[model samples]
Target: MAPLVWLITGCSSGFGAQLVHSAVARGDKVIETGRNAATKLKHLEGTGAAIVDLDVSLPEADVKRIVDEAVKIYGKIDVLVNNAGYGINDDYRKLFNVNVFGALSVTRAVLPYMRAQQSGTIAFVGSMYAWWAPALLSVYGAAKGALRAIAESLAAEVAPFNIRAIDFEPGFFKTPLTDMAKIAQYAPTAQPVDAYAGHRAAMGGLAQALIGNERGDVKKGVELMVDVIRGEGSASGRKIPQRLPIGEDAVRVVEGTCKNALKVIDVWRDDVVGTTDRDGFEGEKDYEAIVKGPDAQV
Candidate 1:
């Protein structure tokens, strides 16, 4: 196969950085991008990967220009990894900008090229929070949830053109993104109320503990991601999962969420199933789920 070209966002640290290393190690051409790419990503100086400065939160035209420059490096882009995160500040607006809209803008820029080539993969680095977020960070989870929804619908729309949009929800991983100390340095000072102080403190303590002792390994998780993208190693002989949960904890949480949803649906099916246009439509007796199998996705 010809060398695949990868344009990845958020290469400054953590999973994004690890992904650049992983892809380059596999001999794929990589355009590693992030803010201050020449400085933050200096560690990759001699790795043969092109360092491209890309601030995903920038204007759409700026993003398009940077992506266009990246595409010129390899003449085409085979994969896009939308892994940028809220850097420095946890302001809710910036969180949505970097985590949600940033990816959308970048994806829109590359989509034309992918459609023309009739092949590509777009991976959105989401979080377990998409399923169930912890306290004090609901906004972050909301952004991830939105990204997941985009991927799910975009996959169906683009499949006919042989492009894939995937959303990867990883549990707490040993990445700078999960570093509570760094987050504290940038987090805004709290305006506390007497009644909520205890609750806020508890959530803060939980975050510090969980982030400090994150369970997922950065390199291993990124390697698995690369394998799936390349259709090698563990991903061989298997179709790439459109919504992949990165670690055991992520899988467990995702599974629990699904089971809980199914339980609610099963409990409410009879009450809610026949209410809407049941009489106007064909007799609902035979409206049972037509697809019945353990592996059924929908």
Candidate 2:
């Protein structure tokens, strides 16, 4: 088999850096991109992975340029990982611009090539917080949630083209991205509100406590991703999960949220059902049959 070509963003550190190393170790060609490729990714020299300076938050022309460079190096991209993202303290707009729009822009730029090739995988590195919105990270969670929705919808849209989209939702892990000092530098002060003063202070304390305390192993997570893409290792003999939740905490949060949602839905079933049209017309007596007809395709 021919070696797979991978284009990954945000290779400066965290999951992106780990993925680049893992892919290269497995003998796959990688086009590793970061905002400051020269300094941020200087350690990757002589690793056989091509480094490109790419800030996903940039405009369409910049995104196109990066994609063009990757294709020029490897001929065709077999996989595209939309992993460039960061959290801002109080700037929801800034966070969304980078986390949501940034990823979307990169995906948009690569779709044409993936569609033409008729074989490729796109993975979005979202967060477990997307499903379980924790306090203080509401905007960050929202951005990830949007990415999750995009991946799900894109999966269905591109299935016919033999292109797959996967959303990897990971919990906290040990990485420079979660460093308290680094985070504090970027964290903006909350707007002073007497009612939220205590809550704000508690959130600040929580952020500090979580630094260096994350339990998920970065290496293992990257390995799992590599396996899924190759159809071997942990993902062998199993269908690729549309949304693969990583880490113990991530699994628990996803499962617990699902269970809680089901319970709430059941409790409110009567009220929810009552909202539907109750009028029984003589012409349409078989309402249930009509409603349960053939599934619609988009």
Candidate 3:
């Protein structure tokens, strides 16, 4: 098979940087991009990966132009990793801009190229927060949730063209995004209510304690992603699912959330409304399964 061409965003550090290395190690071409690509991704220059300067939050025109230039480097982008993102506790406007809209803008630019090629994959680097919400992370969770919705819809939308979309939910990875210290930047801007001060302080203390102790491995996670994208290793012969969780903690959260929902539904079957007007609606609708289609079908 020809070497795949990968374009990944937010290559400054974390998953973005690790994915660049992983894809290159697989003998694939990569266009590593970040805010200041020349400087931030200097180390990847001689590794057979092209570096492109890109600020994902730039105006749509600028993002499209950058994508066009990156596309020229590899002639065609076989895979795109939407890995650039960050989380701010309170500066959610900026958070959504970079994490959500930025990803969308870049995805929009690349879709045209993918559609033209008629064979490509787009992987969204999402979060475990989407499955299991955490304290003080609602804003970030909302962004990831939106990503899941988009990824699922997109997977269905583009399957006919031999394109695939995968949304990966990674747990508390050892990325800078999990750094509790960064929260201090927004401290002055926080508007605290006296009623929840003590509880909020306790949560803050817990977060501070977990700063350097996160267990997720960025390299291993990226390796798994690359393997899945290439259908190699344990992923061999398996049709990649529309959504996946990267870390063990992420898997646990996704499972727990699902089990919890089932338990609630089972316990409150009577109160789950709309049952009274069954009106020949006999069985449960496996709508998600229908919408997702069989992996083999894709």
Candidate 4:
């Protein structure tokens, strides 16, 4: 097959950068963009990929301009990697702008082209928080959760058109982007009274360790993603879950979650669907209808 044309957002750093390298290594054509595309990914020149500036939250017209440029260059976009996003310091609004609204805008821009071509993949870079909610990141979690829902429903809507949607939820990866504290979006304020001291401490410990620690192998993650895109025989026009839970601790948590999910299903099987009808009178003679039949009269 001909080399796939990949349009990746937020190629400045982390997964996007890694993925660009991986794709280029495989001889794929990549149109990588970011908020500071001119700055973030300067080295992409020799990597057999192109770079451009893209702020996902910009106006619809601006996003359309990007779509136009991309289509002009590549003829058609084979894959749309919606990886340009960031947390905000302002709790809800800023996060919404970058993460949720911007993502939607970009997605909407390319959707027309994808549908027209009748073949494409849109991968939303979601977070594990979208599934397992954590403290202090409620707004960010909500944004990702919304994106996941969008991907899920959009899949059903676009399936007939042969457009695939994938929600790539990566657990904590070590990168400059992982420096949540300095990002202006995550500066913590004073705590409330009577907090669960132990739990709060534990959660904080986990957060720092996961976000701050340099553990994830970017190369490995990117390789897995490329595999997802190239792997033949995958369900066409459906969500390809490259839901990578990086790190050993994340692995344990995911495993335990899987186990618990199975146990809960087993325990609630009867309750969920019921084995039999309750011991109630089968006939109306036992308990007459609160509102009598029309023929029964006033």
* TM value for model 3: 0.89
How would you encode candidate 1's per-residue C-alpha lDDT over 1-298 as one tens digit per residue? Answer: 6789999999888998899889988989999998988788898878799999999999999999989878888899999999998743547898899899999999999999999999999999998889987766788889999988898878878989999878889997987766767777777665656786787799878876887688899999999999888889988877776688999999999999999999999999988876765455765355454333322232
Question: What is the C-alpha lDDT profile of model 2 across 203-295, one tens digit per residue?
Answer: 878877888788899999989988988887868777666788899999999999989999999999998965775577335555777456332
Task: List, residue by residue over 220-298, the lDDT tens digit for candidate 3.
Answer: 8888999889999989998988899988889999999989999998999987767676688865577756744345323
Q: Which residue ranges in model 4 land beyond 4 Å of their true spot? A: 180-202, 211-215, 232-255, 258-298
Off by over 4 Å in 2: 189-191, 278-298
Relative to the true structure, how large is the alpha-carbon lDDT of every model? 0.86, 0.85, 0.85, 0.74
True-structure Cα RMSD, model 4: 9.4
Model 1 stretches with alpha carbons more than 4 Å out: 87-90, 193-195, 276-298
lDDT of 4: 0.74
> Each model's TM-score?
0.90, 0.91, 0.89, 0.77
Clashing pairs in 3: none
